[model samples]
Target: MIDLRSDTVTRPTEAMLESMREATFGDDSRDGDATVQKLEALAAERTGKETGAFMPSGTMANLVAMLAHANRGGEVLLEDGSHTLNAELGGIAGVAGLFYRGIHGKRGAMDPDALREAIRPVTRYHMGTALVWMENTHNRSGGAVLPLAHMQAVYGLAREKGVPVHLDGARIFNAAISLGCAASEISQYSDSVCFCVSKGLSAPVGSVLCGGAAFIERARAYRRMVGGNMRQAGPLAAAGIVALETMVDRLVEDHQTAKRLAEGLTRTDASLCDPKDVETNLVRVDVRKSGRRAAQWSADLKSKGVLVAPADLYALRFVTHRHISAPDVDAAVGAFAELWKKS
Candidate 1:
């Protein structure tokens, strides 16, 4: 089957598998595993941060960031369409114990003016803004990359307000590839950043949260509180090491394949998607015009050996990764085209 459902569906590479076999079996929670420390240091270096802590998933990393950065009842401001706000299952509020105000945005970028106005000082009548948040290669907006200028503006405003900034950079490498820059270049705008190796990088599992040494130290405590500690995680960290070293550069191919998929879908039906909006490995197809729900479209495509996920009631999200190729994209597009014709 052509699994366009999500990059999370990607399996580890042979190199990663071999590394896992040769990895140490040290307990990360007690004596501090050498392999885990190596992966954290590498992640920190790649993102230009002072230190890093490994987490089980991007959601936990993000939640730990919020917990470490803000007190309970503090407010977090992020783009309305961010994966943290929509897809992370409300961990921002329920687990981190923070209130969030979703700022108006376009293509996953929060308007600087709106963000500036929303930031407030603590008063008897109100809670102050505790943190500002950003997402790169935004998931819900067809994998749109936030322009550096936009990120700078937001980061500047937050800094002026004395609010810490956290970046949900689950697809940071993808954003970097699309922008022709290093991941650190994109991560530089925020005080803290998190990225997943399990996505396009094709690691079996793991995400890394990077920030100032003190901040990451605090995050490690929160990671333990949230049950994110993976004792004897050297094998997983070994795969992550291989992913960081080898999987990043080839991400451009996934971006190219995604663009091709978007172009083909638009050719079949203009209303489905605009190829220009696809900057990375995700394609958001508008199925509303087909007089059917996004779930129906997903089900229909699944039956034809192509799999996708509904982004919302009216949109379907297609993701490309190392497992997918040009012919796979064409076949998925053909399935979508067939469904379109019937509709």
Candidate 2:
């Protein structure tokens, strides 16, 4: 199947599988796992953090980061389109007992003045803002990359108010590729960052949350509290290590392929998505103009051996990853073209 549903659908490479098989293992929850330890250390260094911890999913990573950063009754500042806000199933409020102030950003970037205004003053009646969260390569924005300067401005504004900043950087590498910079440079703007190795990197599992030593220690405890205390996680770590080492640079190819896909969609009269709007691996198609609901179109595409996902009632999303080649992009466009012609 040509699975454009999400980058999460990417499979592990043969080398990753081999490393997983040969990985040295040890009890993680009890004693420690050397491979997982190495993975955490490497992840921290890459993101320019003092330490790191492993999690089963990016949601848990973000949750733990928030749990560590904010008090139960405090608040978190969130971008309106953040995955943690709209997609994380309310773990911030439900699990962590924290409320969020949503600041709608322009192209997934919050205005600095808006951020300053949203921060509640210290008072008896109001919940004080404790953590500020940001998402880079925002999913809901069709994977738009947050510019480094934009992030720095937010960071500066947050610092003035003494609020800690956490980045839900699940697709940080994609943003890094787009910006032509190291992921660490993007990570430097926040106090904590969580990144997935499973998505575009094509690892089988795992995400890493990196931060200062104290923050990571608290996050590690939070992970254990949430049943993320692991055992013999070396196999997962092995693949993650390979993903970090071998798979980062090739994301340029995925970006190019996504552009190709967008161009193809623009050529087809039925599509409402502008090819110019596509910046990275994700392309959002507005299908309402085509007289079909986004979900219906997604299902129809899936039936025709090309998978996609709905972004909203009017829009569907296509994400390119290592598993999706340039040829696959053309095939997917062809499927859409055929379906549109019939309609």
Candidate 3:
């Protein structure tokens, strides 16, 4: 199947698998794992941060970041559709004992004024706001790329209020490529950032959380508390290292393929969002006019040997990844055209 469901469906490349096979193992609990240490250092340097802690998933990374940055009963300001708030199973509230104040953002880019408004004044009667969270290439919003200026403005607001900012940069590389900038540029505005290696980077598994040394030291303890500690984790870290070193630059190709898919989908009778908004690898299409629910459309597409996702009642999503080549994109487009004509 031409799985356009999500970038997380990608598998490791042969080189990554070989690196994993050749990786040496050591005790991660004792901080004696050479491969894990190297991966952490590389991730930290890439993001211009003081240190990094590798975790099993992006959820764990975000949870650890929240736990490290905010005390129990503290509140966090976040975009309403942010992964940390909507997709991480409410880890902030459930595991970290933090409250969330959500503000709606346009096209996944939170307004600085809105964020400032969301922050609560320090009072003896209220739980104090502790952190501001944001996501780049926001998943629920069709992978919209959050503008760097917007992030900087939010960061400025947070700095003035003495509140920390944490970025759920799960697809920051995709945003960087779309914006024609370095990932570190995005990271500069965030006090802490978490990025996934298993998504567009094509690693089998892993995410890295980067921040100041003291913050990361605190996060390490949270990592263990969350059951993210791994012994002999070098094999996974090896794939992550290769993903960081080699896979980032290729995200532009995925963006291009998504653009192609969006263009083709729009040519059909199905109502779709702007193809120009297809800035990254995700294309969210409105299919209500096609007289099919998103779930039915997904099933139809799957039967035709193509795979996508039903994001909502009126929308379906197509996500391009490293495994989906240009030809696969063309085939997906053709399948959509055929299905639309028949429907």
Number of the top lDDT candidate: 1
With a 3 Å backbone cut-off (N, CA, C), the pairs that clash in candidate 2 are none
TM-score of candidate 1 relative to the true fold: 0.99
Alpha-carbon local distance difference test for all models: 0.94, 0.90, 0.91
The estimated TM-scores of all candidates read: 0.99, 0.97, 0.97
Across 1-343, the per-residue lDDT of candidate 2 in tens digits comes to: 9999888888899999999999988988778899999999999999999989999999999999999999988989888888888888999999999988899788799877788899875589987899988999898988898889999999988888899999999999999989999999999999999999999999988999999999988888999999997788999999999999999999999899999998998888735677777778999888776788888898999998998999999888999988888889999999998887777
* Candidates 1 and 3 compared by TM-score, better number: 1
The reply for model 3, stretches above 4 Å from the true place, is none
**Per-residue alpha-carbon lDDT of model 1 for 23-52, expressed as tens digits?**
999999999999999999999999999999
Could you tell me which 10 consecutive residues in candidate 3 have the lowest summed lDDT?
264-273
Model 1 misplaced regions, further than 4 Å: none
Q: Please tell me which predicted candidate would have the highest TM-score against the true structure.
A: 1
